[model samples]
Target: MNFGPPLTTRETPAQRAQGELILGFKRLGAVTKIDTLFQQGALKARLPRPQDPTLCEAVTLNISGGVAGGDALDTMVTLAPGAQLALASQAAERIYRTPGPAARIRTRLIVQEGARLDYLPQETILFDRFALDRELDIDLQGDAEFVGVETLLFGRQAMGEIVQSGSLRDRIRLRHDGRLVFQDATRLEGGIAAQLQRRTVADGARAVAGLIIAGPEAAHKLDSLRAVLNAAPGIVAGASAFDNMIFARLLAPDGASLRQCLISALEACRERRKLPRVWQG
Candidate 1:
């Protein structure tokens, strides 16, 4: 019998994507305007109607919809002296399953003297086997106020998807007046679900959130924030006040509960401004 010709298989090359966005705002008279803007690849910025005349709002958009392996994004925001700006995302960022390399994200925020900046992006949803690495760096000058919030969902509980294995590395660094004021780093890999179930880890929580408020009045609001967290039911939350910064962390069994707890905590901290419209919808 004659043997058939040898068969061969061809492997497809991995697809890699990269994007960068740079935005700057300046104060002119009583209004803040975009003085510098740059966008490339899949990242873009959208200016929104400001509810406050002195505040400029910017919404970021990821045209690629979601991120997977070998994908990277970089964003930079600068606020001129005396300018005020609020930065948010158009929608929740999604991290898809990765075969190997982890998706990466880097964000840098610079606030000048007497300026104010609020970074309030929506939640980040991670799928099974997804891998992501993210870093946020904030620099503030004299008397600059900065507030930021971050939320993470391990998997879509509504869809019955649970994250059993994956990798996540997140870091946040803040410097005020050339001195480091805050630093937080978290890493989870391999059996994510099992790790989250550990009492010392997440205590079986599916969702987690963190908030940072750094300014003159941060210390004064600690007691109020603690009270709010104590009153919230079905959520594990706590807050601490440092020299000039206040930090809060929350954990819940589901995303909805986590979001409600976060909102309540923010309200207690005197963040009365309405969240971005995208967050509400």
Candidate 2:
């Protein structure tokens, strides 16, 4: 083996996108409002006119358009006692193809006592030759509540795009009252299209989603959530609860079907509450 000069192209600081965003909210009288917010680089947060004073709504935007290898984004959200917040992305995030290095995304969510939070970012579409690694960590203090979802798609099947080769590593961890309640991790590499078609995998599904509801009363709604998942058409979904946490997974034949099922399931998780405006339109 020779340790000569390496010859591999990589994204430079000027060519790669780097972003960091932090948002904090607290309850003031009857309304939960933004306490502190910080954004840098290609990430931004926009607050729409509040329809419900008790729940503050926010939408996140990616200024650099989409994601590519060597790109990095860091996001953190915190809620103080008695505060409520609903957060969503402006639209679906697409991961474009990269040369070698994989793009990275990290998110941290903190909910203090008596606070409630909904983190409902839209789906992520992965194109061919893409590489992505993402992680989400949620820390819930005493009696804090959290509802979140993540959706992933292999490619735009309608556009004749197929994920013939790619790599994705996704992980989520939830801790309630300082104790770990739920965790899920997925790793896929090489010939993903063929891999997803296996009988035990997705059964030819083109899209997939994961939803989690965590709170003191979360487990009680498992039955209803399961019912909603079962009734939805064009998707195969299931739900399970452990302690105060409820977890569900859905697989669909296309993005449109996934969105419909997801919207219904989200409404059920939110107890008939309306989703963020960005999701509706």
The C-alpha lDDT values of all candidates are: 0.89, 0.92
Best model per lDDT: 2
TM for candidate 1 is: 0.94
What's the TM-score of each model vs. the native?
0.94, 0.94
Off by over 4 Å in 1: 1-9
lDDT (Cα, 0-100) at 242 in candidate 2: 85
Q: Candidate 2 regions off by >4 Å? A: 1-14
| Prediction RMSDs, each to the true structure | 1.9, 4.7
Q: Candidate 2 residues 65-161, lDDT tens each?
A: 9999999999999999999999999999999998769999999999999999999999999999899999999999999989999999889888988
| Tens-digit lDDT string for candidate 1 (118-234) | 898988999999999999999999888888899999998999999999999999999998899889999998999999999988999999998998887788888888887788778
